[model samples]
Target: MSESALQSVIHTGDGRTLTRSEFLSLINTYNWFLKDQAQLHLTYSQQDRDGEVTVEGFLNISWGVTMPIRLQIQDDKQTPPSPLITPEISIPVSPLESKRGMTRWGEYSDLHQIDENAETPDIIISNVPPAPIPYETTTLRPMRHKNTEQEAESNLVRCQSDASLVKMRRKAKTAAQREEERQHRFSINGHFYNYKTSIFTPTHGASTKVRITSRMSTHQVIEQLLHKFKIENDPEEFALYCVHQSGEKRKLCNRDQPLWERILQGPSEDIMKVFLMDREEEEVSNDVAQYLNLELPILEQVLLKLREEESKEIQRVISKYHHQHRLLSNVLNCKVSPHIETSV
Candidate 1:
């Protein structure tokens, strides 16, 4: 908060009021005189201006513009306050004289130079004075302690830190638990198709595609599996063979539908056994071809390549066979299948 600045107003010598423009002109003149550092200036007396309120108080103030000083306007209706003191009109003074503490009066104490720094004297405290011994023995003072409120607050901080550590441990444990749960769902034979075809809800609208799955829907697939396994028999004989192999009772064998379904679902030991058996058969066939000193056909080579998982080269050969029809397809009779097929 600062002192309020009041505008210096003058009364016209006439009894009538002057217009606002006239009032502005007089104030401008007053401001210019102050800037010029004039020694004498006109006093804001009552008789100076017409219809203006008598000059009462004279204020020398400092303030910011945005936070302007609020003052009451004195119209012709009311008289203003009396002047307490006149302004000390600015006067020219030499720079040397000003430095030597010269004011309008005379030499004064050089108070302005108090802030100027001077070299400090060195200080040394060699030894501290001993604590005064009490004439009378006093009860041992309870060991000096921190304020109870402050001590309790520090304890609160420790408790909070402990809680934060516990929370972090719990969070880490929860993350580990989630990871374990995720890994548990994983199968060694797991691949993208299983995830894509699994029973999961879509994030959006009604699903267009539906998978109609059955445990043992078609006899053809069973026949194919048996053919791949070299079991040349009807479904009944196959079931019997499977029962004997599994060591299950005849009645228990009826669950072959589910057994086939689970086998097809993969990650199954039975499927792995079939694959391994096929590999062994292929190896035996290769050995027989070598012993006979007979070269394997191009299609057989392609099938072998495919079974060994050289899919990209197999596709390249297939495309080449299609382009050069007589050299490949006609000569070898290569049967085409869609992507993901292991056999020709």
Candidate 2:
């Protein structure tokens, strides 16, 4: 074995470099000493951080029992396009045999054997039958016993019964406790759905109206809004609608006229504008007014109030995303802008 260095030519792209055939020759020389016929698998990993490259070795799987093996190569000098070099190999041995075969270099002892004629150990047998003893007999002592020096003690029937009842109650309570903690993933229309909190800045003609769903803290709502804005460029289509306190009809409209115009220039926006504009034009202005309140302050007030209930809702939704879906939590963490594709 070579001394562990901050680097080896294998990673540093230095030292006596071997061609693919020469490197395999070195591996073959060392591998010839291996006595076991097990089909050993090897894994290799290489990393380059802060300048130098590092190579790591680990067990891929047991010999003979095959598995999908993975390898990572990091050196620019040795990879294809350049003359490829075979990597150096080191055989591993168990700690127990390491000392015996110790050499100035290192030890490579025969550990696991895959002999075809290896004898199997015989199984041991026992004659005893298992017994199920009562809880009182095994754990609790009887109050009375048939002994010469003592008369039979009074019955502990009540005490034993009370203990049994207590145990039963505890068991029942524990079961109920688990049931209480069991989380029910909320669902609607027979499908599991997460609570999506969004801020809508709708545009009605020249007016901009803001509406928020899922009242949460202002910071949390703004953060979520920022995230939405990054992913959804056209905020107007999300539609700001007013559901009046008096149970009036809901009205929806764009809140950012300039943004709405930009959106309408796009093909999808043209379709939406053509459809929704004609539809809204046919309705009475008051009917539109009742549902789509273009009042700016009211919309702003609604956004301001959203945070009052938003903290709990964000917590609930984020927890679900963390434990259930594992979607937004990472995005939330690192404060990764939503526009970045994490997988890429």
What Cα-based lDDT does every candidate model obtain?
A: 0.34, 0.32
TM-score of every model?
0.14, 0.15
| CA shift of 125, model 2, Å | 2.7
Q: After superposition, which runs of candidate 2 have C-alpha atoms over 4 Å from their true positions?
A: 1-123, 127-186, 193-236, 243-284, 287-344
What tens-digit string does per-residue lDDT give for candidate 1 at 1-344? 12221344332332323444455455455545455544322233234344334321111111111111111221223333332432364347654343344244222122232222322223355789988964543366544544999886767644443334444445344433455454332111231113234332222211111112222333433343434222323443322112111322122133333222322223223322111011111122332333343345865775686677877778889988778976765556545644575776
Q: lDDT by residue for model 2 over 1-344, one digit each (tens)?
A: 33434223432121223233443343444234332532321112334554322222111110110121111221222322322333344446545443344222122121111232333333345897878963446356655445653332343333243334444455334333354334222211122222232222223322211223211222332233324223233223232222223323232332222221211122122122211121122223444444354578886776677786798799988887678555556557658665655673
Per-residue lDDT for 128 in model 2? 75
Write down the TM-score for model 1: 0.14
Q: Mind sharing the TM-score for model 2?
A: 0.15
Q: In candidate 1, how many Å is residue 35 off?
A: 99
